[model samples]
Target: MTLTERLNQDMKTAMKEKDKLTLSVLRMVRSALKNKEIELKRPLDEEEALGVVSKELKQRKDSLHEFEQAGREDLAQKTRDEIAVLKQYLPEQLTEEELRQIVRETVAETGASSKADMGKVMKAIMPKVKGRADGKRVNRMVQEELQ
Candidate 1:
């Protein structure tokens, strides 16, 4: 089943079991997917749906950081839980070694000798690592390799 279908099933289960947090998160995800579909005027493929989920996950992480920085432990914990829930839908995260290897290969493929070639390297690598690796992390590794 697609991620959206699976999420709908799980949402039903959450409703039956009275899982408030999971239910709420699932509802939010559904709304985000619906919004994206409306914006694009078409149903999302698996990759596009994954992009929506990844965007939600990024927002939760940002909120967690802001909450902790403001000393709001209660809100921080809630954001952490939301992140954990959303993470179930993302592809397995790329390990540092895997990311580095991909970066090296991309740099070689693009003939990226210095920071000037960062854009080329990034363009080559993003499709390979999308949803699996963080873009900022990939950029950092690319810069390090170039330097």
Candidate 2:
């Protein structure tokens, strides 16, 4: 199923189960997807839809750190819950070793030998790792491999 369809299906299931947290998160995500569709003036393909989901996941993860630092366990927990719901729409994440391996191979494939070649490496790697690995993590791994 398309991501939107999956979200719609799960949203209905959440409503039936009376799962407030999941239902709320799904509603917010659907709104985000709808907004993106409006902004682009066309329906988003699967990759674009996944990109939106990844952005939503990243926002929660970034805020999660702030919540912990501010001693807001309540907010942190809520963000964590939201992340859990968001992740259901994404593909399974790559393990650290798997990501490292991909980075190494991508760097080699792109003939990237120095830090200056980071852009080439990243451009080549992003599509291969899309939705499966965080971009920041991939960049860091590429940096490590190059150095």
Candidate 3:
């Protein structure tokens, strides 16, 4: 099933199962998806839906960090729960080793021998990894490989 269909089904299930946390997270995601559709004046394709999910995940992660820094465990935990829910919609994440391998290959493919070539390497690699790897993690790995 498409991501949108799966999310709608899961939202209904969450409602029936009385899963408050899941229900709330799913509702937020649905709202984001709806907003994105309206913004584009069309329904999202799978990649666009994944982009929305990733954006939501990134926001939650940033909030989680801030909440933890502010010593608010309750808010941090809620953000973590939201992140877990959002993760269900992402492509399976690449392991560090796999990400490193891809970075190495990308470096070679782009002849990226130093930090100056970072942008070129990243531009070439992002499409391959897309939703599968965290951009920051990929960037770190690329820097390490280059050095």
Which candidate number maximizes lDDT?
Answer: 2
Task: Name the best candidate (by TM-score).
Answer: 1
Report the C-alpha displacement of residue 70, candidate 1, in angstroms.
0.4
Candidate 2, residue 114: Cα displacement in angstroms equals: 0.8
- Model 2, poorest ten-residue lDDT window? 103-112
TM-score of each: 0.97, 0.96, 0.95
Residues 60-147, model 3: lDDT tens digits: 9889999999999999988888899899999999988888888988999998888999899999999898888878898888888888
| Local distance difference test scores for all models | 0.94, 0.95, 0.91
Query: Which scores better on TM-score, 1 or 2?
Result: 1
What is the Cα root-mean-square deviation between model 2 and the actual structure? Answer: 0.9
- Clashes per model (N, Cα, C within 3 A): 0, 0, 0
Stretches of candidate 3 off by over 4 Å are none
Q: Which candidate, 1 or 3, would have the higher lDDT against the true structure?
A: 1
Question: Where does candidate 1 clash, by residue pair?
Answer: none
What tens-digit string does per-residue lDDT give for candidate 2 at 5-122? Answer: 9999999999999999999999999999999999999999999999999999999999999999999999999999999999999999999999998998898889989999999999
